[model samples]
Every structure is written in C-alpha cells, then in structure tokens.
Target chain A: MNKQLLWLPFAAFIILGLILYSGIGKDPTKLDSRLIGKAIPAFSKSLLLSDQTITEKDIKGPALINVFASWCPACYSEHPYLMELSAKEKVVIYGLNYKDDKQDALKFIDRLGNPYNMIIFDNNGRLGIDLGVYGAPETFVVDKSNTIVYRHVGEVNERVWTNIILPKMLGTEGQ
Target chain B: MKKLLVTFFILLVILPQTAFSVISVYQFDDPAKEARFNQLVNELRCPKCQNNNLADSNSELSIDLKDIIYEKVQAGESDEQILVYLKDRYGDFISYNPPVKPSTWLLWYGPFVFLLIGGFFLYRFQSSHRQDTQDQQNDEQQANSMLEQWAKEAKDQETK
Candidate 1:
C-alpha cells in the first residue's frame, strides 16, 4: 500500500507529461487587441501613386488603413478585394507601402490600378513596426475618433468584406 | 566497483553544472539552502523558453542564476531574503511563477490547479483498478476452498 502511494505521484506526473506533449505545436489563440480602442500610429511617407509626400492627416475623416508591399504575394491576392472596396466608395481606403523598394511599389500600384485615395511608402518599415505590423496585407479600420476598431492580419477577400467590414461599417459588429 | 559507482554518481551530478549552462540543484548541501535555491529558480523566468517554468528550464540565464542562488544559500541568506534581492534588481517579471497578487493570481494558479484536479482523477482510476483485481483474487480463493470441501465430502461418502 505504501509502495502504491509512492508510485502514484510518478504515474500521475507521466500522465500530465503526455497531456502537455500532445499540446506541442498547437498555437494558443492570441487576442491582439492592443492597438484597438487606441489612436492610430502617426504615419507619413512618399506617395507611390503621385510621387508626392502623403501624411495620415490627409485621409483623417473615415478610412481603411491597408498595409501592403510590392514583394508580398498576399498583397496581390488582396488587390481585387481592394478594387472592390474602392468601387463601393462608401469608406475611403489608404494604403501604407510597408518595407518595399519605391520603384517596385510604384510599379505594383500602376499594375493594380490605384484603388487608394493615396499610398504612403514606409520603406524602412519603422512606421509599420510602430503599428505592430509583422507582415504585409494587414488592414485596420479606423473611426473618426482616430481609434482603430478592426484589424485583419491576412489577405483580404470578399468574405472578409461581406462578413467583417460591411457589418462594421453598418455599426452592427464593432465600434 | 562500489567505489567506482559512488564516484560515477557524484560525477553525473556535478558534470552537468560544469558542462552546460543549466542551473542545477546540487550546489547546496543543506536542505534549507536547497529550498532557497529552488525558490530563487522558480521566481526567475527562462528568457529563451518564454512560457516555461524557470525551475524546469536549462537556459543560460537560469544556470547563471542557479550558481548565484547556490552562492547566496552558502552565505546563509533565507529563501525569502534572496528573492527580495532579485525582485529589487529585476522586478516581478523575472519570476516564472509570479505571486498571487490581484494582478497575477489568475495567471499563476489557473493551469496548475487544473492539472492537479486531472491528477486526482487519474489516481482514483488507478486505485479502483487495483481494488477490482484484489476483489477478483478474493473471489477465486473462496471458490477454490468450496471445491476442496466438495472433494473431501465425496471421499468421505465413498469410505462410508
């Protein structure tokens, strides 16, 4: 009986170890609502469209702040979605050219046909890092208060628009 | 051979501390001192394995801190005293097992408490299994004794 009691903890420990091991490689869901309900980070860059300096104040009213780069394949995937959003014109959209060569970003804008009111080039990516952006094609929906209400981390699609954006614009989903 | 075995065990305990940058529990000879070392390690976070318990981590910082803990224990400081010193320097984030303050009680006790409850169920299951086997053995023994009595009666009847 004493021996069984002694072994119990060890056996229990092994069972716990198996449970923990099964959980390896599974990423815990993260709530990245840090920038949410906070003022948008200040941004200013040379425009990829008109080759003129553009500042965040230029599109201050109500806008979608889309982070994209020429080198990112996901940006290309999101191109059509951006064009569709532009066609709606219900909400103005601005693109922040994150960590790209100026010439390539300009060329990308030309090929995609600019859907943005104006594009801001963040070549060194300082502003992008400040916005907590890790990769390209991230979009944030900002209110008139300058507080970011929504953040999408991956490629934008019709599903994202119909589900997340339209409901947000209609004020049925989030602030 | 016994002498060699003793030496081998000693080396096995001491070699890892000398070889890699892992904090170990062998530095303190006194139980009180060893407890202090454990307390210090538990508080310090392993920077490389961000989410792991420092007591379980073999990271470089953990090793260095373990050495320091060993030294402090030898110097006769209590576990609480050493922890106070570390907290002064590194703040609360240094400890993987943060204290159950208003801010961190949920974080500290949540997972471990769940694990303990799970362990309790496992213990009950193992004990119940052992009890069932013992009961089966008892039943078999009683059946064998009844069969022996029947055999004896038959023999007696034949003799009569």
Candidate 2:
C-alpha cells in the first residue's frame, strides 16, 4: 500500500507532463469563433472600390467573407489562393477591408488582382468587432441561410480551402 | 545627504505613477461609469496579445475593445450586458473570469480538489509517522524497564 502510494505523485506528474508536452508548439492564436451556427451580425458598410453601401441582407446564398487589409502580409500570402478559388470554384467571395486606408486598399487590389465580388470597407472595424475579428486574413464560410458555418482565423490557403472550407460547405449543403 | 536620498526615492516611486497614468485618457461624465469601464478593461483579455488584459495591452485590437467597452458604458449598459455582448462575439475567451459550466467545472474546482486530496494524504502520513514514533518509544521504554528488572533480579540473587 505504501509502495502504491509512493507511485501516486509520480503518476500524476507524468500525466501532467504528457498533457503539457502535447500542447507544446501548438498555435495559441487560433481561437474558435462562438459565431459558428449563428446568423451573421448586422452591419451596413460601403464597398471598398465603389460608394455603394452593402448590408447583411446583401449577403445571400452560400458565400465567403474574407477579412483583409493592405497592411496585413498574411492577406498577401493568401491572395493568390483566393484569386484561384474565385476563378475556378463556384464560391462567392466578399472582402471586408478591415481598418485600412481607402487609397492604400485600392492600390493593393489594383496591384494584386481583385478576386472579391463585393468588397466592404470597414474603416472603423465596426463590422469587424461584430464579427469578432482580432487580426486580418480571417475567413468565414456563411451558408445560404446567412448562418456562419466555419471560421478560419489565419491565412487561408489552397489546402485549407480543399480540406476545411470545402468540407464545411458540403456539410452545410447536406443539412 | 539622507534628505536627498529620501527625496530621490520618493521621486523614483511617484514619478512613474504619474507618467503611467497617460494610458487611460478617456473621460467619462459619471465617475461610476468610468470605474466600470476601468474594471471591465482590466477584466477583459486582449484577443491579440493573448497574455495581457485589455487595460495593459496597447495592441490595436485591445484599443478597439476598450473603445467598445467605453461606448457600452456610456450607453448605460450594465456590466453583465456588456460582458455578454463581448462573449457573444469573442466567446468566453475574452473574459478573464470564465463562466462556471460543465466543461469549465474542472478548471474551477480541480485545484481545490487536488488540495483536499493532498491534505488528506498528508494528514494520514503524519499520523502514521507519529504512531510509528510512539511505538518505537514504547519499545524503548519496555527494553529499559526489562533491563532495570534484570539488573534488580541480578542484585537480589547476588545478595541472597
């Protein structure tokens, strides 16, 4: 009994060490959105390129709202994948220009071909706060019913589109 | 020289407090609202910085959250409503004090449970240790009495 008791602390320590070890090197920044399965927040913002205002009602059918900025390097990295997805895939992509200068954002879209169908200018990040966007390059997969199905916090690449986004979109359709 | 040292110590301690007060510059109509804003910011976790609270973090996201909190406070929203708004958007991760739910019950009670178990084991170990010492002392006393009795019997035999 004493020998078993002596091993108890060591067992607990080993279990704790294993748990901590498993968490090592894992990305802590990728937070799960609470907005999943919830309706997209209501917001009225203007298009980035034009003066036309867009609202939550404008976001109909299955679509992708990609939060991007001229200042965000990760957005640039994901831009090519977005362009490819827009051209090939049937996914409708909207851009939310998060807290960026208008001229700089326009220049960025000009330099890198605009893949977004309707880009919303969220100058004060009012929409962003509602979307719970902490950083740039976060993508949300909104279904036909306007309910947000999936949210990816980092740069969305081809692999992410194929694996995570596409699966969720398919799952949403089946439902 | 002693007076100069004391003055220098006072300056060293007090000057930084004034300088650090620059971070909180938003004015409030009501002092109670201002206090609530301060408390909310301190309690809310900065989504960008991760480790720092909104009050301590100077990140852009933290600033935006602070602004939101200020707006809510000015709008006469209760502290609970404001927190719920944030949690609805950012999830429970935004608040430093998470709500007690089934999933978070372990986090809330795990340490206390461990402490109780540890205390029980420690008490048992100490009592057993004390009993061992007492038993050894009793054996020593018995041996000492037996030695005395043997010596007395030897003396009696010698006398006879």
Candidate 3:
C-alpha cells in the first residue's frame, strides 16, 4: 500500500504535464467576445460617405461589421476575401474604419474596390472602446435584432465564413 | 582610430534618438487626477499588445484608451466606476486582476491546492517512516529478549 502511494506524485506530475501540453499551439490573442448576445454598443458618429451623423439606430443587422485600418497589414491581406464575400456572395458588410487616417483609408478603398455597404469612420475610437475591439481585421456578425452573435479575430477567409460567420449570421443557410 | 571615432559618433547620435520615448502629454489641472490617470493606465492591460499595460504600450488603441481614461479621471469618475465600465466592455481579461468566477476558480485556488497535496504526502511519508522505524526497533528488542531467555535456559540446564 505504501509503495503504491509513491506513484501518486508521479501520476500528478504526468497529469499536469498533459494538461499544460494542450495549451502549446493555441493563439493567446483570440479572446472571447463579451459583446456576444448583447445589442451593439450605442454610438453616434458620422458616416464616411455623407455629412449626416449616424448612430446605432441607423444600423440594420443580419450583416457583418468588418473592423479595418489602412495601416494594418492583415486588413489588406483579407481584403480580397472580403471583396469576394461582398461582391459575389452578397454579404452585407459594414465597415468600421478603426483609428486610421481618413485620406489613406479612402485611397485604400479606391485602390481595392470598396467591399462595404456603409462605412462608419471611428477616428477617435470611442465606438471601438465601447465595442471592446482589440485591433483591426476583426469581424462581428450581428443578427436581425442588431445583437452581436459571433466575433472572429484575425482574418475572415473562406473557411472562417463558412464555418463560423455564415452559420452565426443566418442560422440554417450557412450549413 | 578614425573608424573607432566614427562608430562612437554614430552610437552617440542614434542611441539618443532611439531612446526618446513618446509619452502621453495630457495635462491635468489637479495633481490627484493626474496620479489617478497614471494609476489607471498602469493597471489596465492593453488588448492589442497582449503583454503590455496601457501605460507601457505605444499601440494606437492603447493611446486612445489612455486618453479616454485620462478624460474620465479628470471628470471625477472613481477608479471603481472606470474599471467596471472597462470590464463590461473588455471582459475580465482586460484587468491584471481577474475576478473569481467558475472559470477562474482554478487559477485563484490552484496553488493552495497544490501546497495542500504536497503537505499531505509529506505528512503521510513522515508518519509511515516513523512507523517503520518503530516496528524494526520492536522486532530487534523481541529478538534480543528471546536470545537472553535461551542463554538462561542453557545455564539453568548446566546448573541442574
């Protein structure tokens, strides 16, 4: 019985080693969104296209909010996929231009075809703080109620759309 | 000697330029508010730069957040209210001090549990070790007494 007890520490050490091993390749930056199942944060800001002020009330959902910056390299990397989703798949995408120069952002859109249905310029990042946005190249899927259902950080490619964003946005149609 | 002088000159010029850090210049009317602003930023973690606090990170988001926090501190908002507001948006992960929840229960209590388990094993080992020593000593005493009894019997038989 006492000899068996000697193996207990070794068993515990092995269990701990196995538990820590599972964390090896996981991305630390992928944080779970607290905004999920909640209505979009209230904001009143100006639209990029028009002089009129826009607010949370102006947003209709079952759409995608793609946060991007002209300076972020990943935003450019995901632009082609975003364009495909918008132009071909007919996904309604709202652009949240995060803390970027307006002129450079406009030039980027002009250069690579605007994939956004409407652009909300957040130069001061007031809305971004309210939304808990970490950085650019993050996407949020809002349902018809304007409730954020899913959020994907990094880039939105074909796999991400098919697996997470699409099913989250339209339920059965994604499958 | 000329090459050494040129290298020294380059280091003097470039090192100083590289050492120049961009710091937040938001001026506060009250010294208390300024202190609070400093404390708040230092406590809040920068989301974009995962390892850095808002005070240390130069990321644009961190700068904007520091500005927002400065404004709030200046507006006479308490530290608790500001933290709550941030927690609501950024989740508990934003704070260096995570709250006690089901998920975080292990993190908060794991060390204590590990210590307890170690103490338990130590206690068990020590007691079992003591028992083994006592048992061996008792066996030796019994063997010694038996040998003495046998010697007495032999002497008694010779005397008879």
Candidate 4:
C-alpha cells in the first residue's frame, strides 16, 4: 500500500509534465495551420465598404483572409503587400478588421488605399481569438473548396509570395 | 461631549498622516514621466500571468514593481537605468519583448525544440505500441485456436 501511494505521486508528476510539455512552445498561429486543409470558419461580420454596409456573404467565393488592425504598426508595413494581392483577381482578398475603432480604420484605409474586396469588422477580437490569432497582419489562403490552405503570421512579404504562393499556383508545396 | 471631541481629533490627525504617507509614495503626476511610465508598464511582462502585461496586471507583485519604478524615477533615475535594473532583477522575463541573444537562445527556441522532440517521440511511441499490441493480439488468437483444437481431439477420442 505504501508503494502504491509512492507510485501515485509519481504518476501525478508525469501527468503534470505531459500537460506542460504539450502546451509549451505552441504558437497560437499553429491553430491556423490546423484549420488549413479544412473548411474555412464561418464568416459573418459587418464592415464599411465604399460608404456602404458589407457582410462576408456578399463576397461569396474562395478568398484570401487577412486580419489587420489600425493600431498595429505591422499592419501598415504590410499595406503594400495587401495592395499587390488585392490587384490580383486570381484570388479574392478579404480583410478582417480586428479590434479597431471604426473611424480610425476608415482613416487608415483612406491613407493606405483600400485593398480589400470587403472588410469584416471583429470589434472585440472575439473572432480573432477563435481563429487563435496572436497579433495582426496574418494572411490565410483559401482554395476553391473553401478550405484554408495556407496561413502566414506577421508580415507577408516578397519572400512569402515567392516561397509560399507561387508554388501553390504551380500545384506544389515548398515542403 | 469631551470624549467625542477627543476621538474626532485623534481620528483626523492619524487618518491624514496615513493618507499623506500613502500618496507621497505614489505621486502619479508629472505628465511626461507618467506617459513614459505607462508605456514601459505596458511593455513589461507580469511574469506570473501568460497574457497580462504589467500595466494591465492586477497582481500584487506587478503593483509593487510599478511602485518601485515610480520611486526610482522620482529619485531621478533614467528610464534606461530603470529598465536595466528591472531586467537584472527579473531576467528577460520582465520585458514583453525579450532580447534575442546567445544566452536567450533557449528562451526563444526552447518551445519549437520541445515541440519537435515531443512530436518525434509521440510518433515513435505510438507506432511501437501499435506494433506490440498487434503482436500480443495475434499470439492470443493463436493460443485460443490451439486450445480449441486440443479440446476437439479429446472429444473425438472419447466418442471413438
């Protein structure tokens, strides 16, 4: 019985170690990767588009979802990439405006030049949290099946286009 | 009436002294210093909580750290000195943006390494366990069939 009691504590310690090990070092963005190759999460939000109300359903198609916030400096840095992406009709690029004041986001768009087919406002970051986003300027590529195929955290730069997207276009992954 | 007057006098005198002492410790004035302090607090980590920064943290340690910063700044310490002192005391965990260095390679890369090692072990362990279980089940099935065959031969001999 004493030996059993000793083993009890050892078992508990192993469980604790396993729990910590499993949780440690996981990037919140990796959740996006898990969502990749799976159907995109439901998108239902209202955002300002060309002085009119726009909803996610209004833009019904496979889209590249980019989450951005006006207050995030990183979003400003990635504006050029968004512009280049939006210019392309190969994939519809939609924006999830994450946790920003409406007026400030509008001002940011005006200065940066709007580069979204439609913008969906996630005012309180509820949707962002659900998507396991740590911070702003994350990009996701959805295939024709509406499955999220790619997720890029932080800034999406020239290297991302060269390394990530071009290969997808050519029907291959960089591995 | 005399007792009441004496009590009132004692209360007023003691309370004001205590309040004055408390306020003197946390003088939240000087707009410039206040703004810089706020910015630093927001950038500092609570250490106790995963998601909370010092500015937003309500932990007692965080509050004490803030007060320490306030005291040092009021004593005319430079912002850099305060940052250095805090970093020295708490290690890089004090800062939200921990500096990347050779010493900090573990802090930065530890998680990815852990994940990779864990995944490798999990894959190996599961596959080995699966193979072992398959072998055990096959052995059990074979034993059961052999026992049944022996029982059938004994019954046939009894019938003859």
Specify the highest-DockQ model's number. Answer: 2
Candidate 2 lDDT for residue A155: 89
TM-score of chain B of each: 0.43, 0.91, 0.72, 0.47
Better of 2 and 4 by TM-score: 2
Considering only N, C-alpha and C atoms within 3 Å, which residue pairs clash in candidate 1? B43-B95
Please give the distance, in angstroms, between residue A52's alpha carbon in candidate 1 and its true position after superposition. Answer: 4.1
Cα-based lDDT for every prediction: 0.73, 0.91, 0.87, 0.72
Lowest summed lDDT across 10 adjacent residues in model 2 chain A is found at: A1-10
Looking at model 3, residue B95 earns an lDDT score of: 90
Off by over 4 Å in 3: A21-25, A172-175, B1-26, B139-160
lDDT of 3 by residue, B120-139 (tens): 87898799899999999999
Q: Write model 2 residue lDDT over A1-175, tens digit each, in one string.
A: 2777889889999999998999999889888898998998988989988899989999875889999999999999999999999998967999999999999999999999999989999999989989999999999999989899999998899889888999988888887
Q: What is the C-alpha RMSD of each candidate to the true structure, in Å?
A: 12.4, 1.8, 6.0, 21.9
Q: Return the lDDT, model 4, position A103.
A: 91
Query: Which residue window of length 10 is worst by lDDT in model 4 chain A?
Result: A166-175
Residue-by-residue lDDT tens digits, candidate 1, B11-125: 9998987864453536556877677666666667653354665677675445555566677789887777767755543446556556778868657786998798789878987
Residue runs of model 1 more than 4 Å from their true location after superposition: A1-31, A50-52, A172-175, B1-107, B118-160
DockQ of each: 0.03, 0.73, 0.54, 0.02
- For model 2 the local lDDT of residue A115 reads 93
TM-score per prediction, in order, is: 0.51, 0.94, 0.84, 0.43
Provide the clashing-pair count of each candidate structure.
1, 0, 0, 0
**Worst lDDT window (10 residues) for model 3 chain B?**
B16-25
Ranking by lDDT: 2, 3, 1, 4
